[model samples]
Target: MKRVLLHSAFWLVYLLQDTVLEFVWVGPALKNIPEDVQFWMAFKAAIAAVLPKLLFTYFILYVVIKEIIKGNVRLSWIILQVMAAFIIIIILHRIVFVYYINPVIYGGVLKERPLFHVLSVLLAVMDIGFVSGVAITMKLLRIQLVAREREKNLIKEKLGAELKFLRHQTNPHFLFNTLNNIYALARKQSEHTAEVVMRLSKLLRFILYESKSNLITIEDELRILDDYIALEKIRYDRLTIHFQREIDESSGKIAPLLLLPLVENAFKHGASESRFDSFIRIHVQLQQGRLTFNIENTKENHTAEEIRDNIGLGNVRRQLELMYKEYDLQLQNEPHLFSVRLYINLTSYAQV
Candidate 1:
């Protein structure tokens, strides 16, 4: 409200000042009038001086301010007409006051003042140049705004594509691991073989339906993770896996299938190769508006070749760069343990 009032007041003061100048400064050359009617002539002179300036100021204010507020002004004809019309009006009003009205009131004939030949033409030319410059500036600002919007949309599209590709890669890697477990059970003719197949089907269904979105509720992601852990549990009944969670329900949404690759990497390096007292630990929590994921696994053999072969972990880093650019992820492969610590700025991820 204050800004709007300020805008209106600015125009009012501007128009009032210009009106005073046009009416008083370049006044008429009065002549041959009785002394008794001098007071009336002064009044006429004031109007003649102020009226033209008011009209010109009003024309400029109307055209530019209206365009700014409404986003466009459709007045090409009026803009052109104003320059000629205002000058003519000013001259005609001066002629009528000097020739007819003054004579009737002062009781003597007064001659008409000659029209301003050079001043009229100059005023018109300057007004045209000023209006043209304003129009060009408005057009340039609009073009620059559109270009910035287009650039932001392009970045959003690229991020979405990268996330989709990461999801696709994860799906196959998961399937290969599950099928291998099933193959082992089939060869032994175990009774839990049917149960493992059912679990795999449910996992596939969730990925196909829920994981397609850019973001999903935390509960949905947690459920998928639990189902994955169950499938792995069946494959290795003798191995120990300790899972601890301290997630906040208030966290709104996160990218689906984002953390599964890390879990798969842990199982690959920890459970598949370890022999005795081997364990994989996963701890998740939310604090101070940030989500933290810590995973540590006992690596029986910590080798560079094994870490390079971990395709899912590599893609996770790439996806984080493209999707959550400011995310902090740390990985350490010690002689006895391999650990991954991840922190996501929930505020930043929420924007995507």
Candidate 2:
């Protein structure tokens, strides 16, 4: 129904334009006639002239343009077809004007011209070409709009696939480390083993369900972080861990499971490998739609190559690049302490 209205509007405008042009060209000769009668004559002439123009325009748009876009017809054949159709339409238009319109409008007073007159054919070309050009331009614009929409959808799908692959890579690496901790507790026959298993179950449920979304509330993310920190504390009895959060506003969203890999990297490289007492310090602060996460852990002497080769840190870096445009991930490595600071503008995430 919308398409029908659009086509009707196009032809209506064409008819009005033709009526105005007819008045401008021959209005002085018809000055002796009543104004109402002159307008009626011009409108009648436009109606009579519209039939051939309409047919030729739609034929070129729907038939010739369709075949050209499909690339199914030869160029020479298409050119021959268009030339034949143009000649036939011009002849038909002349027949309509000479036989029907002139007799009614001029009372058969005008001299009869040959059907294939050069002047009549040239007038038909101008009239038909104007309407056809407008229709073809509209058709091409619609095609371009549809092509652009399809391209955007394709790019969105590709990005979604890549994010899923990166998330999958991180999930298994995280579960492996947690499961190893559980194994250690089970082998020692420690009483905290059951509690640790329960915490692991909660973490698994969150990973399986909540982490599927692109974003999650900061409060939910914090809860998961607390749970993971508790599980890690059970595994390392002598390690000093400080997890502090100062949130002025918790009403913000972040990528789910985005911070867990960083925490896991701290324990994997800093606390687990150290022979003496080690400490992990974590600070999370959110204010005015900006979040700052800083984690530092004491470590024994290690080469820069060893720290750079960590899978968890690499995963975190890649996810940050993929997810946020306004974010900074800084790594500070010293002889005895390694630190990571992440600053993100959540306002930008909201815009995205």
Candidate 3:
């Protein structure tokens, strides 16, 4: 329906344009005729001349252009088709003008002209060529626009699939570590085992449900971080952890579960592996739509082989890259300390 309307509008404008041009060309010659009569004669001539032009334009647009775009017809065959159609359309337009238009507009006083006069055929060619060029240009532009839109959609879908796969990778890694914590408590027969299980369930529920969305409120994310920290704290008696938050609640939302993996990495490689007293420091600050998160943890002094990229940090990095265009992730690895700092322009994500 939209295409039909577009074609109709195109032809309507063409007809009006042809009428105005016809009136301008013939007005000075018909000085005795009234202005309204001269305009009526020009309009009627345009209407009569349009039939051949319309046929010629549609033939080239639908038939010749379609075959050329399909790439099935040989170049020689396409040239032959166009040349034959042009000759026939030119003759048809001349017959319409000489027999139909001239007789009516000149009151049958004008002498009969040959069907294939050189000037008339040349004028027909110019008329047909101009309109066909415009039509073909419009057609090619529409095709290019559609192609670009399709390519854009395909890229978006590919990225969405990759993100989902990354999330799948991340979810099991988190579950594995949390279940290990629970397993240790269960084996120890610790009194906090039941409470730990409850917290784990809540965390699991959030992961299974809330984390499905592309973004969630910053407050929701912080709440999940607090829950995970509390659950992990139950496993160790001497672990020192400090989480400081300075958040603007109305700032913006973030990708769900994007930060949990950083905290998980700290607990997995730093505090959990150290034999002596260990500490983890976390600070999350969001002000005026900018978010800065920093996490640091103490680890035992060991060889370089002991420190390596784990799944959690890698997952967080990948998510940040896919989700935010304006963001930074930095890692600082010392002999006894591992630190991560991330900065994100939440307003940019909002714009996206």
Candidate 4:
């Protein structure tokens, strides 16, 4: 609002100055001429006097001033000479129009006297004052635009760095959990421990390489989830783990490493340490430019004490807030089950 008011005030002042000058100087000078002819003549004179100086002022403000402070050779001399030449041109233009043109048409008493030199001096001073004011205004506007652009870029850079840091934190957290699970398997001397290690190696490789990108195909993220589930199933092969996906293969792009946090949270809080015929049902579907994910797990009857904290889920919530500020998120925990439901708009990018 302040900026709008300031700009409005500037334009008001500028137009008022030009209109007043046109009314005062040219309007009276063309008084004896026909109304239509006087209008055209005054308009032409105003253009001839103002256009060149206005163009020159803007060039000096935007181009010369921009380059002059860079310490170029003879810049000061060049600028001084340019200003002197511009003033001379403006003064000459005003003198010719006021003396010869206005006298021939308007037929005023001052036409007999040597009035061109006096009028030229006064008009030249006015031109210089107007040009100086215009230059300062242009300089201030350019500075404001540059400052705004710099601020926007700074914000973008900060968000990029923070998202990268969050991804880094998530990778280590995932590694710690995987290594701990592997250690437990080794302690038990499970026959399928080597297979779990191999699958984990592939998953780690995907995370290290693919997760470095700002964006990746949804298929790649799905493959990472598949690798993680394979590792999980090695430990829970006897229980049911139903994973379903109904995604459009043609639209496959998504933000890299975005979905894993949610999936990891579900597994961390839902799958591990559950008893009494445990089961996890995962559904992922993309429809009408939106992606929906639902994860539900049947909880143990009396093991509520084992799953109280929402560490991974809290991280997922914060990440969602950062990534999809406009999306919907709902998580519910009941006596028999824990579930998460999310619907994210993907129209800004390609959807899958």
Candidate 5:
């Protein structure tokens, strides 16, 4: 639509220049001719006037513009070539107008005058300059537009790479703690030890393979979360915790590893640290291309001098900024509880 409008506007300018402006500027000189003859002569002159300019403009387009853009020709050489071409074009245009068009239109060899010839050639050169100006402007505009599009694509690719990097950067501290849990279980020889190891294997596999992609099904993410929760439960076996999933259209897709950091934080600061009467609650709702993930957990209080390291939440927030242009994340730290609520618009991804 924009191209159509631009072309329409260009041709309208050309039409006005040829039909109206040409006659007004050059008509009074041909007053000796009949009115109809004057109009015909003016029309023929206008056509002949623009023909050489078109040829020169096309030469600039096909050869000069290409060479200049590619840096294959020096600026000084280009200017020299244009000047030499302009001289030849003006001379040929004057010759053609005097020998062919005027004799045929006037029915005789008109005055062989130098001043008139020089003036006409000057006018023709001005028209050629006009054509050159328009051609250069349009060519530069197209080049700029192409450059802008390439820049936009490059930015998208960079953002995508950053988001993937952040996802792949799973907390090393979490892994370190889980290994200690497995070591403790081995010493105890509990039946649940094998189950915990299997869960850990599954969690590692999911992180290494399934979460490699930028997008995955909500169901897949939930399963990853379940494995993680099970591992945490084994690590802190005596905590009273709740994980609730209220899912509709669980097949909805989202960026992988987005919600896991919040859950990890909940366990790190809430359920694992509390002495007694502690609880962690997680709720996930997926329906109609929208996701609401909420986690609230009982937290122990500390003064400003004592604060848990918050690098995990900071890193996840950065990843979310890269993945989503419009999303909702609320982190609330009340006196007794730490809560995180995340909302996402998933209309673009229906399945994994």
Candidate 6:
């Protein structure tokens, strides 16, 4: 639709330009001819200008300049064509000037002023060439701008696909770890084993149905996080988990399964490893089209091999980068503490 409007507008503006030229010639060329005929004469003179422009416009733009840019036309060849164009334009300009501009404006013969005539004719031809050059330059700029926009869109889509794949892979790895937790409880014949397995099944169903999607609402994700936290509580009675959502439930959406990895990493490395100081603190909220999620966990140390080798957190980071160009995710370590802060600008990237 935009292209159509631009195409129509270009021709409409060109026609207006030609009509202005006709108005300029009409006053001088009245010649006692009938009023209607005088108007036609002026219009014809304008056509003489526009028609000459058309002759070289496409030839220079499509054939000469395009081929040269594509490396299919050589420099020497372009030089020769330019020289030929000058000769042709000079002849064409003389014909139009002698037959149209001079006769209409001055009622004079062609050879009456040789030097003045040649200079005027050359100037007219060069003027047309100059207009055509400007037109081509604008066209080249538009083409380059469009190409660059397309390249940027392509990169964004590629990253989005990678993010989707990464998130999908996370589902199974998480399931594996949770199943191990359930298995340990079952081996002990603990009374909460059945309840834990039921909670795991519910979490699995949510991951299977919701995480497969391109986007999940903050409300739904928070519910999933709450359920997972319950399962963690069942796994370890001593674990202390603090979860808070400071925003409205229906605030915004995000790429699926994005927040889970951050929480999971905290619990696995921080709460699971530190028996004495085992706790996870989480806070989330939406502000000005952005979601800020902050999590801090008590950490004994950072040297756990599982914590260092984890790719699940890396996957979430990559997904955040792809889905939200305007986002901040920082994981920092302090004495007995592991902290994560993620800020996502949902307005920057289109929802899937």
Which is the leading candidate under TM-score?
3
lDDT per residue as tens, model 3, 1-352: 9999999999889888998998998788778889999888888888888887778778877898789889999999999998998888888888888878888776764455687777777888898788878887898888889989999888888888888888889989989998999899999999999999999899999989988898889989999999999999998777999999998773379888999999999999887898989999999999988999999999896544444567887877877777887999988888878899999998676222
Candidate 2 TM-score versus the reference: 0.90
Writing each residue's lDDT as its tens digit, candidate 4 over 1-352 gives: 9866864676456655664565566666555666666556555445555555555665666566666656674867876867776776665656555665556544442344354577666666677567557757777777889989999888777777777777778888888888888888899999889998998889888888878776677788888888888887777644688899998763566677777777776666666757546788889998765788898887655343433435466566655666664577777777778777878776554211
CA lDDT for candidate 2: 0.86
Q: Write the per-residue lDDT of candidate 2 for residues 250-352, one digit (tens) a residue.
A: 7688998888888988998888888889999999999988899999998897655344737777877777777787899899888889999999987776222
User: TM-score for all predictions?
Assistant: 0.64, 0.90, 0.92, 0.65, 0.73, 0.78
Worst 10 residues of 4 by lDDT: 302-311
List model 5 lDDT by residue over 323-352, tens digit each.
666668887777787888888886643221
Q: What is the Cα-based TM-score of model 6? A: 0.78
Q: Which stretches of candidate 2 lie over 4 Å from their true place?
A: 106-119, 306-311, 350-352
- For residue 140, model 1's alpha carbon misses the true position, in angstroms, by 1.3
TM-score of 4: 0.65
Clashing pairs in 6: none
Q: Model 1, range 1-352, lDDT digits (tens) per residue?
A: 9846854675456445544543343334334444334544554444444444445545545655456456665567555666576656556545544555556533443443444546544553454344334444554566678778898888878777767877898899989988998999999998889998999999899899988877787677777778888888777755778888887673457778888888888887688877766788888887665778899988776563444536788788877776664688888878888889998876676343
Is 2 or 3 the stronger prediction by TM-score? 3
Error of 5 at 221 (Å): 1.6
